[model samples]
Target: MATLAHLSDLHLGSSASAARTLEEAVAALADTELIVVTGDLTENGRTAELAAFDRITAPLADRLVVVPGNHDRCGDDVGAQLMRGVRVDVQVRGGCSIVRIDSTAPHNRVPWLSHGRMCQQVLEQVDVALGAVPDSVMTVVALHHHVVPLPAEGFWEQVSEVLHLPNHSELALGTELLKVLRSRCDLVLHGHRHVPRQFIVDGDSARPLRVFNAGSTTELGAFRTFDFAGGRLLGDPRWHQVTPEPRPSPQVWQAPVCALQLA
Candidate 1:
């Protein structure tokens, strides 16, 4: 089976204590074939913050894939240029297709579907990336901001002014992009909201797509491990929390969640 390590919302500058969490998470991910970070790598998208990320993930450089969140574009430094958006389509071990899409822009800080033109272009880019992958392959699309609302409806509504479309047409456009990807993929992965979620889309009838939201590793104490084989996705994800040791503790602390299934 092929294993992928997924985490998001590291939010490095949120606190100095956050480093221990990063170290623990990275240690857990060292063995996976691919490591996917959904977004918000930094608390404010500062150069030093991003640099810290580069250093932290240095050992896994060749296998890591990352995208930007609203926070990554809001601060002083130009992160887009630093990361070059890190958008690309690649094949994972066991022949699964992995597409990393960049949905946020450097100048656009607020989280919204207001950048319709850019969103359309990125969607088209995703389509092209999928087309290049063989039909027999299992596919996983990764991004920063979530395309669909999560269980935390009340919280999302507050940011809907910048995130969701006020009208159905705009909403349709945002969804259509995902629908197109669903046609050729087995799963979708994203993170922006700090809460963990799993959304299964059965609207296609003929093809079912599972969207796994890895949530925020630094903030919510959540992360996932996926198993795949050949070109098919197999088994449910194993989620766990990485607890931080007290300042005086001599060694790092780790926690395991026995009941990790998500509907």
Candidate 2:
């Protein structure tokens, strides 16, 4: 079976001390057919931080898939460099066609915008991109924003308050995008919460879709290794969290058995 790697929230300049973790992650994912990065490439989207990450991921450039997080958009370019390198929506190797959708809010001046919004045009573009996929291939939809509110409260809330972190989701969550996505795709991946989670969304289609957030790859040293064949994921999802210590975090989340569980 072919393996796909998912990583997110590098927060490069912010998490620069995790240099060893970055090195290990890149080394670990070197063998995967595709590596999906769900944004937060830098602390504030600085050129140097991007360069740091680019240098770290240079080995996997040919197979890399990425989307910009709010932090990455803080720079003047609005993570334009990240999008520039992603030339195709579908993989030439086929089997899996991953379409990247930008969920970041608009910010022309000083890149002040945060949170997420899909907009009608973005949804239309997402539709057009999916049209390029073949029916036989499995589809993976990726974006920087979480369509639904994730559990980020309690102590985390206080911490965020202290850190001055803004609202995690967009002022207007484009649930319409989720409704549209639920009908067609097999898997949807996103990461902005800086927390790793696996969830099931019941779409109009009989087959429920899987959603995953890999957390902060560089800072938290979190990442996922997926076993898939013919564009469909196989068995349970096996995710790993690399810690600074000798011990690492390994977690498994199985596909839900009951449809109501999703509801």
Q: Write the residue-wise lDDT of candidate 1 on 1-263 in tens digits.
A: 77887888888988975666887777777777878887788887788888889898888887887777667776664447544645454645435667877666644454342231235666777788888888777788877666653333344455664554541112224466666766588777877665566666664355567776676777655467888877767767776566653332212112222222123
- Candidate 2: regions farther than 4 A off: 85-94, 108-113, 153-166, 170-173, 203-206, 244-263
After aligning candidate 2 to the native by TM-score, how far in Å is the CA of 79 from where it should be?
0.8
Cα-based lDDT for every prediction: 0.65, 0.67
Which pairs of residues collide in model 1?
A: 111-162, 112-162
Minimal lDDT window, size 10, model 1: 250-259
Residue pairs in clash, model 2: none
**Model 1 root mean square deviation, Cα atoms:** 6.4
Give the TM-score (vs. native) of candidate 2.
Answer: 0.81
Q: lDDT for model 1, please.
A: 0.65
TM-score of each: 0.78, 0.81
